[model samples]
Target: MLLVVEDDQAFAGILKNLSHEMGFQVLLAGTAEEALSLARDLTPSAIILDVGLPDQSGLSVLDRLKRNVHTRHIPIHVVSAGDHAQTALSLGAVGYMLKPVRREQVAEVLAKLEARLEQRMHRVLIVEDDERQRDAVSKLLASDDTETVTAGTAAECLELLRTQTFDCMVLDLSLPDTSGYALLETLSQQDAYSFPPVIVYTGRELSADDELRLRRYSKSIIIKGAKSPERLLDEVTLFLHQVVAELPEQQQNMIRQARNRDALLEGRRILVVEDDVRNVYALTNILEPRGALVEIARNGKEALERLATSQLHRELAVDLVLMDVMMPVMDGLTATRAIRENPAWAKLPIIALTAKAMPDDQQRCIEAGASDYMAKPLDVEKLLSLVRVWMPK
Candidate 1:
């Protein structure tokens, strides 16, 4: 759901039409007061806030929302005809879409807004012993322009869970008050409602049994290393996306159908093989929610094995494969070569998921038997259009 707060009636109508066309449920307001009242009454997934409102400035409203406990986390995309992009961003707006907004631009902004909301809507509690590390992780989640709450220790995290709700958690294995595994065990004993998804983000190395045990309770486990902040963010995003993307297709369809009944997809399967967990998770999260069954393989070898073993491949029911280039245990190029060697899988639609945006890289993937190529950090909206093109009605 999105809330559009704009004073101009005609412009508001235009936004509504575009939002509906792009498959978004929109709530409109002509004044800041009305916007605030509606927001207080019913929380929205995202807000497209105009800088100029009749009653008050949008910045003031944004500040109010940030200060309030109830609405602080709802993502806001500030739209303005004026030159206040820097101001909006500095004030904590997720995105600033400039005005005289083109249909394409609006679509792009809304698409990003939806992605940001989807990532954070499932709340995750962060439990870290180090204040600095805890702060850093909190900023990363909030920096993507999403909502997240943090706790410095396991005790605080458990207390937060007792009073509030969360979609998942990022637990540091080494905590001052208690070990991350202990918290996981306690949460598992509780019912599913009290048990949010857990992701272990710790520096500690574990035995295979410990890793398996953590997986039994948590969604994913990440080892904190000397990886760059960007890499860490990617891992976190990947973990969150996987958890949310697991929702039933009917539930996802309901979200789409509520916004636009015309939104339809006759079930299509897209197999994405990417070494980077973040890319795979983000892409899968977006695609699965749109009525596509997404199958993920960590590396090229795993992908090949799945292609050989899956019943769908035997029937030629697998629609597409989004193959990543650089991976362990056989890169995409080698995997594609192996696939082409086989008569049965030679004609499968393969698309390269490459970080190399260069023209030569695209040509290489295509030469390796990929039908097409998409750059890394896949945009949710563009990928949807590409899927529609390949899987035509």
Candidate 2:
């Protein structure tokens, strides 16, 4: 059963016809009040919600439904002509589709909903060298609808991933045979294995460079602490899309406490070192709205000058540097080496950006003391994620 919540009768009819072709029993609601009533009265498999409504806003309805324990488990996909995709996603919507959508796009959303609803058990893989820690984490995440598999090394983890499918993976950086970074790199290349969203749960604190490397493959990083278990549980359930109502009361409370995302880049200062004006504009656009102060340096020589000037003024000290690999005067590699040479800026985080993401380029960046490397034609979301990860706490 699928709930179709829309004010437009014509479009609702079209959605119903399409759903019928896919063998779904559709229930219609023309307004926010009716939709809420229908949702509470009958819990459907999934919901297709519109942002606009006659009496109230659909985003309000979404928030209400997601907050309620009874209906929070039902996946909601928001369909709107407005630009509310980011807001909808943050509010727990499974997906978002802009209006004037093609039939194929709607069908894709339906297919995803169907796939999620059809899954019976969510499997999680725990890869940790410490036997006691692995068992404890497994016990903490264990549930009736969840199955957990434990592996002691990268080899064992790779074998299990090749043989079976999993919803998520909890990894530790330290392993006897191989590091977690290597395992992730291997998984990215092999198409034979079922790659799952990874949560890096480790006892050790990561350096800026190490953290940058891990960000390429891991979805969330959890350093072990008194409150880490709660956060780990929250992230796992989010990825699994488990029902909050079905979880134990204590677990639910812990999850609630850890659900808030940190404002990583707020009030932070980032120096963008690029010769290209277009990249400078793009980077500024992405960072400024997130409450970051962006400073630009046209070339490597100018970057050095900026750093030197900042050293004399504490208020102008840059928190991070986005270094373009190729520049007119003294390239990114040289700038990075020069930065490393200075004792004051030795540990400063500098992420090198290159047009080519080949192995040679990545190695060159690392050799030049870059904290990490990102390829050109950047993925906007991924770039943001990396920035958040590297941002100093």
Candidate 3:
């Protein structure tokens, strides 16, 4: 399905009709809120966004979507009166279209999209010690036409590289023969496949310096223990260089369920306690697509109030909380303690988010009753992985 987010009804209709004629299932949203809601619920293949909106800038919406692990992977285009192609591209938009929309330009752009979707030429190298994790990630990534090569250690990976070429590499940092970092540095020196887009999948908690160093050779980083096998697939998809997202809704859902740990979070309620509006928006963008009903509070006090009122007045139960470590009035650690103190919510899953990666800080969150703790500037894929583990399948 392709979603066209536009405020102008007539223009929206024009785009919808045009999309359908071009062999696409179409969905339309008139406001940013509707756009966001539908983007999550429908999990559209691509989004044609309008810059001007009744509620918010399409650029803002794009920023939020790109931060989401699920929706971030979908292709998006900007359709607007003014040219925002440069800004949009910098922000992750695939392409842009000017207003006074024409069938020719739409056709040309979508033809390119269709060609991308129908792609089949791709191969990935999986470097990990755990066979179970390796297979799980490989399943999500291996379409019928794609080939996956697995290596149990950095040494094995190096040996494979000398003999065969690959489109991508999924690396686990800790290896028996050598460090994944050393392996990446080694690859950078080799003349093999032009530094194929690399993704780091590891259990090690990296410091800022470590992350900076890895960024030299890798496209992304996802911590392993955070239910991260699916994330490895996500990173692998980035290198696949193909597109086929224009399938029917049922087919799309089926494929999504298959790729997404073999299950989608269809009915779930989640609370995010964070003072940053942007973070809340990003989190909502990610969770909504996974079928979670999301609610937000700026700080711990409001979170408590919302939790209490929902349980007592609405007779509703919140399934999980994504709590921010630093906040006004009440911080995540304190909030975690308060929630645990209430017997009814004692065992509720609470995941802490912090800018700090200090061991002491993580321990504090755990001691205060948080189920897990993640470093912020979130690794989006890692965040979702953790959420999936804590929530019921």
Candidate 4:
């Protein structure tokens, strides 16, 4: 659900509709008090907060939400007509969407939140001797999305490790079983990649050496006390958010590669040899936008002519050639051999397009000195992959 905290009815209506179009249930809040009340009630997945609330300053509202255990996990975006983006961020807003926000800007902000929500937050394992303290830790950390498991001592924690995996760990320094120091040493021995991040949420005060020793095993040590719950949540949330924000770009690259888009495939010269005009147009449609300068030939005979001319003229040098298997004037096999015979164009790559079911077609093209062969009707991605391989970087 999306919560829009705005005083302007007209603009609020616009945002509500836009969010609905993007598949979010919209809730409207006109004042800071109303926004806070709605936030506590709905616990929105994301918030679009207007800084110009009637009752109180929006930053104050943001502060209140951040301090609350139930609402801080919900990401907030500051919307403003003025330059308060930096200030809002300092106060704990995840992002700032400037106003008057257009449909495109709203769409972009939604996309960011969508990406963030798609990632799973950390699964934490809490290790403590005191049952009350352990249950309290669980209560503070667990939400609709986060998972928590408790281990009372080092032996129990080690036993759990044999069967479970955690994203982060909350530890108690003083335990009846093995000490936290021993547990840290044991956990530190796991291969770096598989080791879960450890957070030392112990009450005991430490010397310089103990602190240094804990540093090798855990992410941080938070001494348990009055303000610790909020501080602990803040630290844990930072780790979880970091995982979402630093997610490998290749993971997000699935959409781009979905249509076999060659986004970075640019600035190359290619010649397409095909008798059919439709095939030429299809090839152009895909290649031109990728910044390729595509030239055309009616048949394999004209392909040879173009290759000969390109070899003689340096500026016209074709980076690669896509040769059609059959043509009215001359076949692609003969043109490929001709291209290979010339010492100047010998190193040039010529890929043959052939029927998908013909087993001997590829071997025939290879024998004729073609660089590679792809079956038609061209798979756009396979074609682009072949182009990338042959084109000069």
Please report the candidate that would top lDDT against the real structure. Answer: 2
Instruction: Report the number of the highest-TM-score candidate.
Output: 2
Better candidate by lDDT, 2 or 4:
2
Q: After superposition, how far is residue 95 of candidate 3 from its true place, in Å?
A: 8.9
1-393 per-residue lDDT for model 3 (tens digits):
889999999888887888888899988899877887888777888888998786546766776665454577677888889765654653456678888878789888777667656655668888888888888667656676667889998778888888877766777787888888888888788786345556676776566577667656434433323445444444444335233353234434444443543232445688999999899999988888776788899999999999998787643568889999999999888999999999988778899999888768877988999977788898776577567646532
| TM-score for each predicted model, relative to the true structure | 0.34, 0.54, 0.42, 0.36
As a whole number from 0 to 100, the lDDT of residue 23 in candidate 2 is: 84
Tens digits of lDDT, candidate 2, 1-393: 999999999999999999999989999999987999999999998999998776445776776676566787888999998866655654557778998989999899999999999998999999999999999899989888999999999999999999998878999888999988889898988998888767788766566677667656533444432337876887677657788878878878877766443334656789999999999999998888776899999989999999999999987989999999999978999999999999999879898899886768877998999876788898665466556545553
Q: Write the number of the candidate with greater TM-score, choosing between 1 and 2.
A: 2
**Across residues 1-393, which tens digit of lDDT does each residue of candidate 4 receive?**
989999999999988988898889989999977898899887889898987676545766776675455676678888888765544653456678777777898888888877767767558888899999999889877765578999998888887877777767777787898888887787677643334656677665456477667656434433333225555655565445432223335422322232232322444689999988888999999899876889999888898888889868877878899999888888889888888888888778788987564778877998999877777898774577567545532
Please write out the lDDT profile of model 1 over residues 1-393, one tens digit for every residue: 889999988889988999998789999988877888888798887799998775446766775664344665577888887765544543446668777888888888888877765553556677887888888787666533246788887778877888897755777788888877788887778763366656566565456567666656423444433323443443344434322134445433333333221122335677888888778778867777666778888888998888887645444356788788989988998998888888877667687777767768877987888766667666554455445433422
326: Cα error in model 3, Å:
20
Selected candidate, larger lDDT, 1 vs 3:
3
Provide the lDDT at 234 for model 3: 40
Compared with the true structure, the alpha-carbon lDDT of candidate 4 equals 0.73
Worst 10 residues of 1 by lDDT: 255-264
Model 2 pairs in collision: none
Every model: Cα RMSD to truth:
18.1, 13.5, 14.0, 22.5
**Pairs of colliding residues, candidate 4:** none
The 10-residue segment of model 3 with minimum total lDDT is 238-247
Off by over 4 Å in 3: 1-54, 57-73, 77-115, 129-146, 153-168, 186-192, 216-218, 224-393
